[model samples]
Structure formats: structure tokens, C-alpha cells
Target chain A: MSILLHDDTRVIVQGITGKIGSVQTKWMLQYGTKIVGGVTPGKGGQVVEGLPVFNYVEDAVKETGANASVFFVPAAFVLDAFFETIDAGIDFIVIVPEHIPVHDVMKMRDYADEKGITALGPTTPGILVPGKGKMGIMPASLFAPGRVGIISRSGTLSYEFAGILSEKQIGQSTVVGMGADPVVLCNLPKILAMFENDPDTDAVIIVGEVGGEQEEKAAEFIAGHMKKPVAAYIAGRFSPQGKKMGHAGAIVRGSAGTYEGKTGALREAGVTVLESPIHVHAWAEKYRLR
Target chain B: MRLHEYEGMDIFEKFGIPVPERGVAGTVDETLNIAEKTGYPAILKSQVLVGGRGLAGGIRPVQTPEECRTTAEALLETEIKGLPVREIMVCKKAVIERELYLGITIDGYSGRPVVVVSTEGGVHIEETARTSPDKIASFKIDPKFGFYPYQAVALLRRAGLDGKPLNACADILVRLYKVFRQYEAMIAEINPLAVLADGGLMAVDAVLEIDDSAMFRVKKMLSLSPEGRIGNRLERKGKEIGVTYVDLDGDIGLISSGAGLGMASMDIIGHGMEPANFLETGGGITADLLYKCMDLILMKPLRAVFINIYGGINPIHEGAKGIVRYIKDHGVTLPIVAKALGNHQEETWEILKSGGIHVVTEAATEKAVERLAALLNTSSPMSRS
Candidate 1:
């Protein structure tokens, strides 16, 4: 009943020999993510977290039947890594690199969409089904296997909220990082629809920021189709216009992507919108207590 | 990155789009010389990135060389929107019979490129879309396919525009699409695509904003970033150090790891204290970056500092070390409260505690912000804006 990642979603790590890649791989392996092998162009024979490393994604796929991938490659090489994963016929791709050029990301996303592959982020924390499997850089300590599905555009805020929900004995079915890039592959609506269909997810919480209209679009999808009770906590309500707030996609433009704009839309769609991150526990408490 | 009018013209010419005859000048003498060749009644526009140039008197009509020289001098001396004008664009002002709008932008909701067109121009398109929704029309570009003239032409026709003129506009759009794609522009617009009395199209004004994330690949944009572009000093400093810092008219300084958490922290802090600036490091926090961020917020005399960070991908230990180093190096006496957790939470808290930082261990950020507000209330006021 989980979305994106499933029991059979065998994964491979790209740029596994890199420092961040190796460390995160160790953490992911520790969390019991079904990681099969690794990929590093030059360091093919090297091992990371006891996983066999290969130069090409195809080789790893051929050997392990890996259907998913987590990219830990640098920004300069992300496009190539993205194409490699897509070519390898990977169903789900999680991009960890944050600074891939906007134009490069556009082409990468376009190609991914063309291939019908679900790609996560250029600057994403990755997705977690909690206790099932984890991907990307989201710390596993905060996540617990539960009933609510959480979708967010931020990596840290999701963890911050996840910890809050977990503290209240409210676990999550799955938490998806919608990525931080402006031209990210998935949006809130797409992920929201998937969460609605998942039997394990009874309620969903959308963690949105002020920059883009991901929240607004999801509001439309929720107001019409979603039957499950939804709660949302949006960030950047006080963010200044034109300031890139940590995330490339989270910028307050002229009369657009405002926190009020997003929150208002979500509220109109009949969702419980939290006042601040501090109120997250209360929001989840009400949902769980119900 | 919003390109200046001169830089926009260079892009327009590079894309083979039709624009009026123009030349740039950095000095008064250069302005007179360019105006002399362009003939009398040329437009002198102070090349500042801020809008409202026409109303702000940044744009002036000069009939004589003396007027041109004087206008250029005053423009170069004065500041538009508090930004000192570094360059002036001298150009032949063409006659405008009518105004039209054309733009290529990323549709945030759909996450795709969109070509927007309207006969109603020379005004804010958003305003037009709000007041007269039928005046403006937009066609969302497919993410998979290339934006061709035929598509723009079809879109224009569907938007109630017709005739040979649309083909011309469509041609310009195709070229503009090249500029939009190649430069990785978030927005490339020609507001007031002036229709001459003779029925030819000329881009009256160009607004080309390259995506800041893609600026690294566009090598030419490297030097001009935050150069006379950002009016705020601390904001410019933040950009230089690769951190997201927004100066506000408030008191408490803020530092957070993620934008969502940063803004959430702002909301909690704003309940009791005014946030002086919004600062977030994303996943790119280093000791030096954090040190510079602390220095940046400290530039304005603040009441207290509230730092809410979580170490996920970002190294909280290294970032905490930077904060400790900054506090010790400057011998800071301000009330600094930091709520740090995840990955290296213990080491981060230890380092902050050593620097006299009020550290909050629990994940809830209210604890840190609440402690800071209590501390600030007790501390003496440092009057600043």
C-alpha cells in the first residue's frame, strides 16, 4: 500500500565512492534500505557500505535487477547520471545533488518525463516508507512506520515535522520529499493522488514552502478528488520577495508563491493548516486521536 | 539575475530579435557621443535593474548633446531605488502605435515552459490578467518537445491574434525561446512589443532574468551577480558567501538549515520578536559559510540571534564549529540561541555551549526561540532598523 517505493524496489547508489555517497550509503544500509550495488565511473571495483560498486548503472541493474536509484553525484555530473539511470530503465530515481544547472535540470526532467520514470529531486532529501526502506539523505531517526502520508518540498523541515509527529506516537505511512529545485520532476498534486490510493495512508500532511504553487495545485486536487482528511504546514510565510530561501524553487515572486497564497488555497480545500512547526504535534494529535 | 537594459539588448541582438538602435555609456562624454550618432531626440535611460524607470525619471528624452550629457551625468550620480546607476543606455526611441506583450516563463504549477502573449501590453501583465482575463493568453509548452514558431503562431491565433503580424511575433518568440533556453532564464519578456505606424514589431523593452541556479553555466553572468543589482549590503554579502540571507526591517537575527524550517522559525520568533533577517544555508553549509552568515546578520546591530538547524545532509558539527569560531573571534556579547539536532546534534550542542550560545536540545524550535525572546526581553535594547 506504500507509494513509490515498495517491497521489491531494489535500489542502486550512483556516485557511491564519493564521500557523502559513502557516508549516506552506510546510513541507508543501516536503516535496512534494499540497496543492492553502487556505481562510480572510475572507482568501479571499490566497495561502499559492503555493496559491490560498478562503473555503469546497467551493469548493476543486470546483476541485481535494481529498479530504483539514488544519485549522490556532483552537480556537474548529475545530468549524465540521470540519463544513465533512465537508460538503465530504473523506475524510480532520487537525485541528491542540489546545484545542477537549471537548464540541465529542465532537460533531465523532460527526459525523465518522456521515459515515464519517477524522478525525485535535484536537491531532495529523498523518500521514505519508514521501517520499509529509505533513500537519499533523510535521517531515519525521525521517521517511524505509521498511518499518515507526508509530502514536502524541504528536506530538513520534513524531518523536523516527522520528529514532531513521531514524538506524539503518530507514525507515517510514507514521506516523500518533492525536491527543492524549481523544475523538480514531481509536484504535490501527483504525490497527493498516489497517497490517496494507498490503503496504508489514512491522512496526509503537506509540508510546503512559499516559493512555488505546488501547494495550490495540490489544493485543487484535494478539494475535488481526495476523500482522506489532509493537514498541511507551509513554510516561508514571512519570506521576503525574490529571496531564494535555501531552496532554488522557494522564491516569493510578484503576487505569487506567497505563504498566504499557498496557505489560503490549502485552507479553502478543507485541510487543517498548522500555524507553525510547533503546532505540528497538535495537528497530528487531533488526526491520530480521531 | 535581472539583466540590465543594455545586457538585454545584447541578448536580443544575439538571438536575432529586432530591437531599436542602441548603445551603452558609462560616462557623460560617452553618452553625448552615442547620442550624436543616433541623432537628436534619443532616449537616455539609466541602466539600473530596478523597474519604474519611466516614473522614476531614470528615462529622459534628450534633444541636444548638452541635454544628453547633463541627463547621463545626473543619472550616473543619482541612485534609482537606492541602487547607483553604473551604466546608461542611449537609444533611438521608436514611435509606438500600439503595444503587445510576449514572454516565455516557467509555469510553476505545471513545471513546464510557457509562452504568454497578449495584445494588451505596456502595463503589468499580471494586472491585466487580473482585471481583464481575456486580454492575456498563455500556452503551456510541453516539457518533452521543443518550442517552435508554429506552436507560438498557433497559440497566438488561439489567443485571438491573427494575420502576418503574428508570424513576425511568433518568429521573435522562437528567437526569444532560444535566449530563454540557452541562458536558462526564469523569465524572458518583451513588454510592449511596439507596433510601429508602419506595422512592424520592435521590442520596446526587454526583461531577461536568468535563473540564478543556472548562472554558473552562463559564464557572462558570473561577474555581474549582486554587482549594483542588490540594494541591500547584507544580502549582497550573503549571495557572495553562497547563503540565502534576506534583510528585513526587524531586530532578531535568524539562521536556519532549510527554507521551510527557516520560515517556520521566523513565524515562531515573530510571535515575540522581530526577525531582522532571514538566513538559511540549505545543504551547502560550511564553517566559513556559517561564519560569514553570522557576520552578515551581525552587520546590523541586532537584539539577539536565533539559529534553528538540523544536520541531515548538512554537517551540523562543522556549522556549529563555525558559529563557535565566529563568536570567539568577534568576542560576541549578544544573546545567541541555537536549536540544533540530527546527525551530529551532540557535538553541535557542545560547541555552541562552549561559545556561550543558549542551546536547545529538543526538536521543537519553540524552545530555542522562546529562550531567545526571554533573553532579549531581559537584555538592553539595541536601537536599529
Candidate 2:
């Protein structure tokens, strides 16, 4: 009923021996995700959290039929790990590393596109299908099964939005964090298209920020092709010019990436853009009433 | 990180891209010595990161040693666009037949590295791309195949470059792409890829911006300027401890989780008091790191401190522990407002209260900002307890 992930999605954890990978694997397992196996390059033929470990993704896939992958590799090794995953035919991937070099991201995006694989992020918090399956590092307690599909560029903002929706008794069908990088693989348009096809998803909430033209492109897509109700909240409205506000991608360069431009574009596309993150509940309610 | 023009040129020179003979001078004597070796008609350009240096009189052409010395002296003493010139690059001016632009940048729209070239060059390529889009020709480089020799030639040819100039320009474009990839650069630009009267091409100006996150891999490139730190002292200290902090012109010191939330918190401030700083303690930040972040932000002269956190990977408990430890250690009496949600929210709030610190329980940023405004107004005249 959700987009990208479901109950039958057998996931494999890459870099499973790393501290973050181990911890998140436990969390995902506790949430009832079908973690079939793990892959740590050096530490093969081992057991981590009751799952078999292999050296390469291909080995893990051949042994366990692992079709999905969640990478916890460091930024330096993300490129190599990404190529391996793509080569192994893991159609679904969620990269958890941040600060990956832009050149590597370009290559990864290109290779993923050519091979018809779904790559989530090089700096993302991962994706979640409420009460079905979870991949990546999102805290599962804040989300509940609902009809609203959430997509965000910020990890913590995604958690905050999900928390707000959960508090208002509104839940999400799926929530995807597109990472905080300037160039991400699964952008708003791609995820918007998926949400449009999910039958359980009644409305979509897009959490975007200043910097990059992804939001404007999403606005254009929604204007022309979408049949689902969409509401968005673009952050960094009062951010100072030329200062990089934490995220490497969250910057305003000239007139290209600005809050005013993104908000105006979304509003013109007949989408209700909120001024605050907590207002997603109100929009969801409006959609529900309609 | 944006490299100074001289530094970028040094990389270009290393990669076999032709550039004018140049030397950096910090004094009048140094300028004269460089001018003597570079010959008369030397160009004195100020070394500053910001643009519009040409319009700000940061650049001057000196034909005599006396003019060079005086120009260097003036530039060294002068501030162009609020950035004082600490060094001036003296180079032999080129006999230009035409000016063309060549640059390689990651196109955000396409998610690919694009090579942009224009026959009409050096007068702001962004403006040229906006006004007459046809004047600029761009080719998105496929990362798997890279910028091939044929692709570079085709790109230059499309820009109306032909014959010897086209070959020379194409060679420079290929080398520039090498420099871009080798150094992990975000932008490798030569504004005026000057074509000499003898039909020779040289990069008269260079701009290279490397990815800051790639600093771990590109050590030698960063070592070119060991003291070239990006921000003020507070901001630099924040960087050392994994926190991103930017000082602002306000009195309320603010710390938040995500960059978007940090900005949203600043925007939500209702009172006249502006945010003194923007600090983001990234995901999985430890208590010790959070304590360090609080210590750094508290160092600034502020009316109050607001801590807004929405934890995902960074648990709320760690942030709470950091705040409590800071309050207990410093015995700070300044009005502190905190709002935490997600992962261990209840326990985090309880810990903050136990440490005798008032926590803002509102989930909305505006409500928290309102609470801080109310606290600041009511506590302005009250003595520290």
C-alpha cells in the first residue's frame, strides 16, 4: 500500500559491522522489517543480530534473495559501495552517508538511472512505510499508518512533520527523506509520481527548503501531471544570503535558489504551501474533508 | 572552499593549463620586485574572495615601477567591497585579441557536471546566460565517460571557436576538466580565457572552488593556504567541534537540529531581539559535543539562549544532558528556553526540569519563540538568581 517499500521487501544491510549500521539494523529489526542478511567487506561469514553476513552484496543477494539495500558506509567508501550495490542488482538502495563528493553523486545518479535502480540518497535519513517496513535511520516511534504520504529534504524536519501528524491522529502512508544534499537521487518529482500511484495515499506533504531547483521542478510537475492533493512547506525563508545554513546544499546562490522563488512557484501550481512545519496536519485535515 | 585567484592559478599551472606568470605580493617592495621580473605593464589585482573586485578599483595596470609600488601600496591599504586586500597578485598583462569564457560546474538542474563556454567572455557569464542564452553553449559531462577530447572540441566548436583558437581552447577545456576532477572542485572557471594576438590562448583569470567536505581527501590542496579559514573565530570554533555556527546581528543565541529548523526558529522570533547566532548540531551529536556547542554559543553577549531540537538520529536525551550539564557547570542565570521532540522526548524534558532549567514544551516553533519573547520581556529587569 506504500511507495518503494512494503511487507515483502527483503532488505540487506551494507556496512553492517559499522557502529551506525549495527544500531540502525537493530532498530529496523525491532520494527519488524524483513532484514534478510548483511554485508561487510572484510567481515564475511559472520552473524550480526541473528542475520547471516557476507563479504559482497552479490554474495548476500545470491544467498538470501535480498532485493533491497541500506548502506551505512562512510562518505569515502560510498562510491565503491554504491557501484557494488548497483552491480549486484539491488533495485532499492538507501545511502546514509553525508558529505559525499558531488562528482561521486553525479556518477552514482547516472549509473542508477541507466540501470533502472532506485537510489535514495548520499546524505539521506532513509525511507519508511508506516507499520509495514522501514529502511534507513528514521525513528519509527514518531510515525503511524495513515493516508498522507510525506517527502522531505531535511531528516529532522521529516521526523518533526511525522510527529506532528501522529499527534494530530493523522498518519503517513510513506515518508521519504531525500537527503540534505544539493543533488539527491530521488527528488520531489520522482517521489511525487510514486505517491500519486499509491492507492492508500490520500494526499502528499512535501517538506523542502531553499537552495537547488528541485522544489520548482516539483511545482512544475504537480502543475502539469499530478491528480493528488499536495501541500508543501519551504524552509529558510529568513535565512541570510551567501551564508551556508548547516546543510551543504542549503544555500542561496544569486537569484537561482531562494525561498521566495520556491514558494511562489509552488503556490502558483495550485499547491498550498505552509509557513510552518506543524501546519501539515491542517492541510491533511482539509484534504480529508474534501 | 573558494580558493584565491593565485591559488587556483597555481593548480591550473600544475595541470598544464597556460596562465600568466604571476606572484603574490604583500608589500610595496615585493610588488616592485615581481614587477621587475614580470616586466612593465604588470597587472596588480587584489586578493579577496568576494566578487566585483574590478569595479571596486581592486585591479590596476601599472607600467612603471613607481606606479606599481604606489598601486600596491594603495591596494594593500584599501578595502574593496569591505574585504581588505592583504595581498595583491602581480602578473604580466596579456596582449588580448579576444576574451572568451570557459567554466565547469555541477548543474543543479541536471545533477551533472556541465562545461559552459561562451565566445562573449569576461563580463559576467551569469548575465550572458540570462540575456542571450544562445551566446553560451553548455555540455553536461557524463561522469562515467567524463569530458572526452571530442566532446570538448564539439563544445568549443559550437561556441563559434574554430581553427587554431578552437584547438587551443578545447585543449584548455580538457585540462580545466582535469583540474576540476582532480581537486574535487565544485567550480573551475576561467572568466577570460584570453586569446592572444598571436592566436594563443591563456587563462588570464581563474576561479576554483573545491568541495569543503572533500577536505579529508584533498589535504594538499587545502594546505596551500593553512590560515584561510572561512568564518570568524566563533564560527571556526564551532567547525572544530562538528557544529555549524554563523554569528548574526542579534541578542538571542539559538541552537537547533536541522539547518531548516535553525532558520525557521530564527524567523519565528517575535520580539525585537534578533537571533545572535545560527548553530546546528547535526545528527547523532553526542552530549559532550552538544555541551561544547552550548558553551560556544553562550560565549556571545546575548539576552537569552533558545535551544530548539527535533531529534531523529540525534536523540533528545543527549541534547538535554548537554544543556543540563552546561547550566549546572556555568550556573548561568540568563533566560534559557528549550523545546525538544522525537526520540526520548519525555525523558529529555524531565531531565531539563530536574536540572532547574525551564523547558518550552510547545511542539510549534512559533509558540516556542513566543515563550522566549515573553521570558525575555519579563526577565529583562530581574536580577540573576
- Which 10 successive residues of model 2 chain B have the least lDDT summed? B376-385
- List runs of model 1 lying over 4 Å from the truth: A243-256, B220-227, B378-385
Segments in model 2 whose C-alpha atoms lie over 4 Å from true places: A243-255, B79-82, B160-164, B221-223, B270-273, B378-385
> What fraction of the reference interface contacts is present in each model, in order?
0.44, 0.41
TM-scores of all candidate predictions against the true structure: 0.93, 0.92
Give the per-residue lDDT digits (tens) of candidate 1, residues A175-251.
89988887788777889999999999988888888766778888999999999989888777666666321111211
TM-score of chain B of 2: 0.90
Candidate 1 local lDDT, B349-378, one digit each (tens): 888999999998776776666677677664
Q: Alpha carbon lDDT of residue B216, candidate 1? A: 65
Query: Evaluated against the true chain A, what TM-score does chain A of model 2 have?
Result: 0.95
| Strongest candidate by TM-score | 1
Candidate 2 accuracy as TM-score: 0.92
Can you give the DockQ of every candidate in the order shown? 0.42, 0.42
